[model samples]
Target chain A: MKKFMNTAETMVAESVDGFVRAHADFVVFGTDRQCVRRRHLTPGKVAVISGGGAGHEPMHIGFVGQGMLDAACVGHVFTSPTPGQIIGAIEEADNGAGCLLIVKNYDGDIMNFEMAMEMAAGRHAVEMVIVSDDIETARIGEGRGRRGVAGTLIVEKIVGAAAEQGRPLAELKLLGDGLNGRIRSMGVALTGVTVPHTQRSTFTLGATEIEMGVGIHGEPGHSRQPFSTADDIVRYLCETISRDIDVQPGTKALLFINGLGGTPPAELYLAFNAARRFMEERSIPVERSLVGTYVTSLDMQGLSATLALLTKEEMTLWDAPVATGALRW
Target chain B: MKKFMNTAETMVAESVDGFVRAHADFVVFGTDRQCVRRRHLTPGKVAVISGGGAGHEPMHIGFVGQGMLDAACVGHVFTSPTPGQIIGAIEEADNGAGCLLIVKNYDGDIMNFEMAMEMAAGRHAVEMVIVSDDIETARIGEGRGRRGVAGTLIVEKIVGAAAEQGRPLAELKLLGDGLNGRIRSMGVALTGVTVPHTQRSTFTLGATEIEMGVGIHGEPGHSRQPFSTADDIVRYLCETISRDIDVQPGTKALLFINGLGGTPPAELYLAFNAARRFMEERSIPVERSLVGTYVTSLDMQGLSATLALLTKEEMTLWDAPVATGALRW
Candidate 1:
């Protein structure tokens, strides 16, 4: 696979270092090298920290700044950070207001962040919010129930905004956990991801085949299907989301179309248009929309559709100002 | 070939419609369907207008908001917009102050924009700035001298800020033209781009080979070279740009690393780190840095590095607040 990287052992560290330098005005490395925290933290405000593998960028790292994540504990590509790294971020980001950990529903991620919280028990008041918004994984209902995907962005954004408003740790956790139930995401992979360490694609498909409901870490999706037109694919995704969540008529939604690294903006917009049309046909009004590569899968060729049923308050939070490397408004 | 598009004929229009809708708060469609203009235009401010083929998105279209282009006349994929469309955008964006066109250095774009300027001769005072910052094309010293690439964003951003400050048409033109000379850019392609219309890649390279100095429209570059590490590739790019223009040891530069659509944030930052090291070793300071996929070539697995020697004033202008779909701060 063709990629711009150094040795696999050093790729993540180099990338994290480069990222901090590029946005030095907005973020800084925590005492722990793997942890990145906001350059200017707001004291007395709930410090919201989130992280996972390094490959899904602009997700955790790009969200670190005012009105978003206070700190992000970056890990090796597609690998979870250790508990020590998580606690380092927690210690650095927490002011007097306490800390909230937003963890995606993943085996390694949950275990590590949980350990970090237990380790920091006496010193800090910590609350954890686990996001599980992947509809396909929910359908399986076996191990881990559901895996978080692009909808995690919505949770981060809304929760981060709330944290900036001086919300307490418990409130922030409730806000994030509430958002998880409202958000549903599903992705289709046209091509697999090549891990930096392996230098090989996690999976392969025929030229005209696609994997629907793929996980971010290159996990096998729901099933392989014949590649179809953009409208058809988006229609299927929208339908699945609507079916998973019993959407009544006239429900307001925040339709988010996320490119999985390799898809271009034009195609993302096409998917957005398709999703918008589908919502319209179902009498669902999309009050807010975000389309771009905010959450990604390490240069994987695909796109994900996220629908967050939003209340008026949630919509206000989503519309709140956020300034970060990947997202700003 | 696995692109998320409906059909080539409808792709641009659909995408444009989706874009305007997504950024409804920032931009709107002009009377002419192909033209996208700022939703709230400053009546007396010099209207800055730009356009090109569709593939390089978030360039002309995404720049159509406050502190940037007033309007963008979008064209078909890898094809220049018609003179009629250009005139339409000009008429829609122009106010009492006048209009300035930011045209990239391409034969079709130049010819069509020139024709549009003549067509709108007595109606609106019009001036054009041609940007050609490609170091590779300049070194060749043939044809169009140099072709504009990622550096066009710098010109638009700086000139757009100047226009917002009530610079006249002629002054804006001069500012944009002057910035072009200070900017130098070079790109490397790891994979070719597939046009939506053709459903075929424009070019192909061997697995272990890469194209250096490739153009935004997938044009042939200086030469194909053996694939190398990120540092080596970025070091070569920085050296070429530094040589093309006699970069002084103490010169302060704005190092911009742009993804060519498909490259992910991790790789881009790795490139940024390498470029930063190269500048540091040369004793040239990077006063500012912007790394992401601002300018793109439509799902081509590649990236470009742009170096703009910035003065204090230009740095201020670069940091000016911009609220657009793709870029905002």
Candidate 2:
């Protein structure tokens, strides 16, 4: 497969520099490797930070701003950002109000961010929230945790809004925990994406098949099934999310139909429409919905749906003003 | 070429339905054709609505919400939304707030949206803003008229924020027009994206060649040149945008490094870093920047850069809170 870059080794650093240059106003370099709050540490506002593998474009970095994360430590392509990077970001974004690290439930990310938090705790007030919103059931005996996927965006938005409202660290952590119950995400891949350095597709799927519940780093899904119609796909995806979450009737929901890189909006919408019909037929009250490529997997052609149950208060917070690269509400 | 769908004809409609379902709170549908404001339209807030082909996911639909677009009419894949669809969006979103139709400068989108605007004018207060941000030299002596591409996002964001602040129709049109002078965009495509129904890539580029100035619908670029480093590509792209706008040294600008779908974030940042280095070397002040797959062309492996010269007021508006599908800030 053809790729675009100077060399595989410089890919992550080059991307980070470019990202900082573009958003110089809201993001800046910290400790040579991490992105920190452009604003001076606010004395009272609790700082929120997160990071992970670099492939998810707006995930860790794009989410840094006033209403979301204050810093994001970018990792190597498909690898967790280094603990040093995360620690630097924490130090830079932390105000007297304290800091919260929002780590995805990936092993690499968890390990790196946790280490960073521990390192930071030696000198500063820091807290953390690990988001594990992927609802795909894990193997019964393996004890693997649900992977974090698009649902991270919902978590960031909610918790970020709360942070922006100047919620204290402990309160914000509780809010993050509360939101954990309301969110669930699942994804499927029709085709595998090629890693630029490897110049090889990360995982393989047959032309007429899809792997349901694929991991963001191209991990295999629970099962490989034939490519199905949009409706079938939606039914399968929504069923998984609904089975995992007790989405009751009359409850408002925030639905996110996310593309994993290469899926066209047309296909995304088709899947989105089917999902909506499925939910409506079951009397699920979808309060707000988002469709498009929010979280992606390079050029993998598939989609993920995240459902965020909302109370009036959570909806108000979700409606709060936000300024970020990927989400601007 | 693999595809996803039960039928080609129902693609756009199904997608729209799905978007509405997911964002049910802020999104409302009209007669199975139009998606519009879920916020009760105020009696006098000027509503801004836009639409075009389905391929540009967030352009028309994703912009819907507070401080951006009130509604979007979606067309078939790579096809303009029908006049009826556009008209319905205008009617549904209009609530005494004279509606503003922000159409991209594509012939089909312009023609179709114009027809719909005319159809809606007799019944409600309406206005329009046609965005032509693609800086590619228009057909010979065609003056400033060019196809609209990624720069439309800046236009939509600034103008949408203004409209959300309850600007009148005339003022919103003027704000959009004022933004036109400050904004410019250029793009490169490494590979053509295949439209689902056609099962054929829209345009072709050699394996080691890149198409500069490519259109969102896969129109040919100014030239196909040998693929080069991300810095080289960034220099080429930044030069085009800078020259087009005559960005003087020390001028503050909003830079958008937009993905044309399949390009990975690493390459995007590499290019973004190069562009930043270029701008900094030239002493250009990048006030705010966004790097990601904001506007895309299905799975086209490419990127576009847009520079918006920021006035103090526009910068504030740029920092304003916004809620939409693709962006939340």
Best-performing candidate as measured by DockQ? 1
Backbone-clash count (model 1): 0
lDDT of each: 0.88, 0.76
Indicate the residue-level lDDT of A120 in model 2. Answer: 79
True contacts kept of 2: 0.67
Give the DockQ of candidate 2. 0.48
Give the per-residue lDDT digits (tens) of candidate 1, residues B73-169. Answer: 8998888999999999888888889999999888899999999999999989999999998878655665788988899999998999999999888
Q: Is the docking of candidate 1 incorrect, acceptable, medium or high quality?
A: high
Q: Which ten residues in a row have the lowest lDDT in candidate 1 chain B?
A: B243-252
Clashes in model 1: which pairs? none
User: What's candidate 1's i-RMS value?
Assistant: 0.9
CA lDDT for candidate 2: 0.76
What are the clash counts of all predictions, listed in order? 0, 24
